[model samples]
Target: MLQVRVSTFSAKQLVFSNIDNEFIQLAHPRLWMQRICKRVGLPILSPHALRHTFATLLFSKDVNIKFVSILLGHSSAAFTIDVYADVY
Candidate 1:
């Protein structure tokens, strides 16, 4: 099992912010990722790719499938297995 740190913050706080410390709009993170990838000479990846990678990594680590499904907001572990069977 993984242990996560617990912190207290306001419900309205932004998880990510712009350079000026203002709230970031929905598309800002993807645009920033594209710009950074171009600047660093790396292939641009979509947020969905990152999410898939995260799931693959977790599956590789032998975490419980049900737990991973919950984290990914899947309706059931069977769906997660069906989607990521290649990872296994």
Candidate 2:
């Protein structure tokens, strides 16, 4: 058997914890997203925008739509093509 060793650190030392203690609790995805948007000086956008952005970027990079659909957990490749064909 192969062995993998992991290092453990206190929550205080974690990068996510450095972002916000509130992240320690399960809150809205939008809350953290809004924080990031504001920090970057962009208009506040829903978390879904990130998914759409990923799909659009992958399309621009010429990654296959079927692969993108699977990564996005869509049930059908045609659905992915239908939804983002205009952007592509």
Candidate 3:
């Protein structure tokens, strides 16, 4: 619940990156995720996989394809349906 609030009010641009407070490199989150996966005993998942999962869940809920397409930054709804036709 608190996580939701922080994300809602705080910077929506970068959740992990603190440009003003800390200097981060590309390898930071990579190593962090590796440690987390090791501790949780789950397969490592990439950002792309998470994004796909989010879209799949929204489609499964019968959300508008055009809305999903917009959220995904796609050029058009037809392309979204073309890529995710199986879900529809």
Candidate 4:
């Protein structure tokens, strides 16, 4: 967690506020994230990092790459394997 501080009455708030109860797009609030990390002590997260973590966690759980590839919407399981071979 970035552990960012806000002056809310509760002393805890979701910094990267969301809208529409939807997932955040990769480029959504990009500059805001950079500025927040610049102020906080957290490293800048790459756009692919979340995807990479999803794949890596699946691999760690012994999930088949073919299933993961299908879930990832990749053209082929082989391509997914190729891209995340290090995690395997």
lDDT of 4 at 2: 55
> Model 2, 1-88: lDDT tens per residue?
8443322454345323324332454456778989989999999997789889989999999998889999888899998988987996
Candidate of highest lDDT: 1
lDDT of 1 by residue, 1-88 (tens): 8543323365444446644445767887788779988999999976678899999999889999999999898999999999998896
Instruction: For candidate 1, report its TM-score.
Output: 0.69
Model 4 ranges off by over 4 Å: 1-26, 35-40
Winner on lDDT (1 vs 4): 1
Distance from true location, Cα of 48 in model 1, Å: 1.2
Q: Could you tell me which 10 consecutive residues in candidate 2 have the lowest summed lDDT?
A: 14-23
lDDT to native, each model = 0.81, 0.76, 0.77, 0.74
Q: Itemize residue pairs with steric clashes in candidate 3.
A: none
Instruction: Point out the higher-scoring one by TM-score: 1 or 2.
Output: 1
Evaluate residue 79 in candidate 2 and report its C-alpha lDDT on the 0 to 100 scale. 89
What residue runs in model 3 are displaced by over 4 Å at the alpha carbon?
Answer: 1-12, 19-31
In candidate 4, what are the lDDT values of residues 1-88, reduced to their tens digit?
5554444454235334553333555576677667777788789875467678988999999998899999888999999989998878
lDDT of 3 by residue, 1-86 (tens): 32332343554546466544345687777778778888999898665677789999999898999999999989999999898888
In candidate 4, which residue pairs clash? none
Clashing pairs in 1: none
Give the C-alpha miss distance for residue 64 in model 1, angstroms.
Answer: 0.6
- Tell me how far candidate 2 lies from the true structure as C-alpha RMSD in angstroms: 8.5
